[model samples]
Target: MSQTLDMFATDDYPALTAGVDEVGRGPLCGDVVAAAVILDPNRPIMGLNDSKKLTEKRRERLFDEIQQNALAFCIARASVAEIDELNILHASMLAMSRAVDGLQRAGESVKPEFVLVDGNRLPKWHYPSEAVVKGDSKVPAIAAASILAKVCRDREMCELDKKYPGYGLAGHKGYPTKVHLEALKTLGVTDIHRRSYGPVKALL
Candidate 1:
């Protein structure tokens, strides 16, 4: 199967810049997570695909490698309350913006000439950006960003799981799985749950 995504590979752009991605946009609870990664084009990591395609263990391993090897990177998030107020789409864009902002604050030399973001929707940022479909699978930096965002969101869900035991957040990571929906039905919605989401809102 041809897994390559043409969006990132076809364009002969400037020097390899930063890639950004986010997770937890569809979750019933927790904040939107975003990561910005600037990779060394000369020393690219092998087997860099979408984080969703890799096992949790493999993704975790790659997470460390990406961190150690990346030229510059940053992970950022927008809270659940912020999502509720701005809506998930805008909140995710905001998180992506923050991640870029953080990278700029870290150092001027590390700033990106262009930002490659995963997914088709363009982020509402002033920076020069491109939105690529299936970018995480095609672009190494985007894939690294996906892994970082996923792991960070998973860690947050695990913490939430401890505070709210019955929800099984650690298992589903706030996704609307059958068990998660059942938990909502049985235990009622928690403060962390997104009241605007259809599945959780129906119960409310």
Candidate 2:
């Protein structure tokens, strides 16, 4: 017998429950961005899926849709300095916590009663929460959050690309791609490059 996973387990949660996700965890540069989204059950969004599985244009479109339709959403990030200081995993948790805090602040009247995080780990926080592996693909709210975080970080990378000019931050979004590695070897590590990471650490 095939075992089927329940994708909508969090649907029974309180109305104010939020979905949380982070982006840029695998990137060798740029801040890790996280988003918390409290979706309005009355307003369901279409075409929500993992940000990586969607085309850039599709993700952008859904990003706008999520911003306009979600009951509340907040984007937050841990900067390069924070990443270097605390390490990427803890920094990512810091970013996720900030995102949840921001969402609560933005929607002051209606705080989240619960939280569903995308990855297998949960940030140390007071909210009742559960971590769902690959939640972005299975949970609509997580999918929305993923798109928001991804788009926000990608835009920042584009700006960094303009400033840096050679690292292909815009194309690879600071990921340790072939072009990015070549550029790093040629131009050296920049301020935004995560010094704790192996490739960038080697260069330094």
Cα lDDT of model 2 by residue, 1-204, tens digit: 001223566657888889999998899999999999998878888788888988999989989989988999999999999999999999999999999988843447346889999989999999999998888888888888999999999999999999999998889998889999999999998888999999999999
Worst 10 residues of 2 by lDDT: 1-10
Candidate 1 C-alpha lDDT tens digits along 162-203: 999999999999999999999999999999998889998899
| Worst 10-residue lDDT window, candidate 1 | 1-10
Residue pairs in clash, model 2: none
Query: What's the TM for model 2?
Result: 0.94
Residue 193 CA displacement from its true place in model 1, Å: 1.0
Q: How close is every model to the real structure, measured as TM-score?
A: 0.90, 0.94
Clashes of each: 0, 0
- Give the Cα-based TM-score of candidate 1 against the true structure: 0.90
Cα RMSD to native, each candidate? 2.5, 3.1
Look at candidate 2 and tell me the lDDT of residue 184. 94
